[model samples]
Target: MSIWWSIHLRRDAASVPLARRLLLGTMETAGVDPDISYDLSVALSEACANAVEHGGDGDSAEAYRVTAYLDGEKCRIEVADSGPGFRPPSRPLPVRVASVEDEHGRGLFLIQALADHVHIGGKPGLGGTVVSFDKLLKWREDAPLIAV
Candidate 1:
């Protein structure tokens, strides 16, 4: 069985929780493990927050998009923004930060730690940035497969 959903929302703080809640509810209804759901939710929140913070040129018409896909034993999500794309780091991102007092810069680190696979890139036509991640789902043995 497979399931998917996608939504476009204004690039604002409120959209972060809305995205998280929707993802959480979808996972819960699909019988995903609570721990995995929590982890994914946090990662999704970070992604959405980044999009809200950096995803536009102050254009009210611009919006961010969040998409979720559940296929077999895996769940994948994508958060994309309509802002100027950033240059990808030439090397792999560090897993740890040097300072605890740093007020920011931890979102990508957290996302990498929580997700099983992550891909960050610019949208086609240099339109914006996209953060996409996937996690292998771990369902309880008693849980039945959901219909798509």
Candidate 2:
């Protein structure tokens, strides 16, 4: 079975958890393993949090979009924002921070570490940013499984 969903939300902090909760619910209903679902939920939270924090120019009407698709054993998600696009870093992303006290700059790093594949790009003709990622879904050996 294949499942997909898309939602556009105002660029606000509350929208972050809303997006994460929707994704988590969908994965859970699809029989995704708890651990995998948790990891993806956390990653989705980071992605949505980044959108809420950096995805607008103080315009309350601006919005971000989240899309998810589950096909076979893979789950793919895309988060697109309405803010000025940014060029992705050209070097390898660091997995750890230089200082424990640093409170920022870890979203992309966490997303990269959690997702099996990640793509960052500009929304075509929209003058904004899009972050897409995918993960291979795995089930525990003894768990009830849904045929994907």
Quick one: best lDDT, which candidate?
1
Model 2 residue runs over 4 Å out of place are 140-145
- Tell me each candidate's RMSD, in Å, in order: 1.9, 1.9
Local distance difference test, per candidate? 0.89, 0.85
Residues 7-105, candidate 2, lDDT per residue (tens digit)? Answer: 999998889889999998888777888888888888888888888888889886789999999888989999999888899877657677558887878
Q: What is residue 44's positional error in candidate 2, in angstroms? A: 0.7
How does candidate 1 score on lDDT?
A: 0.89
Residues 19-70, candidate 1, lDDT per residue (tens digit)?
Answer: 9999999888888888999999999999999898889998756799999998
What local lDDT does model 2 show for residue 36?
85
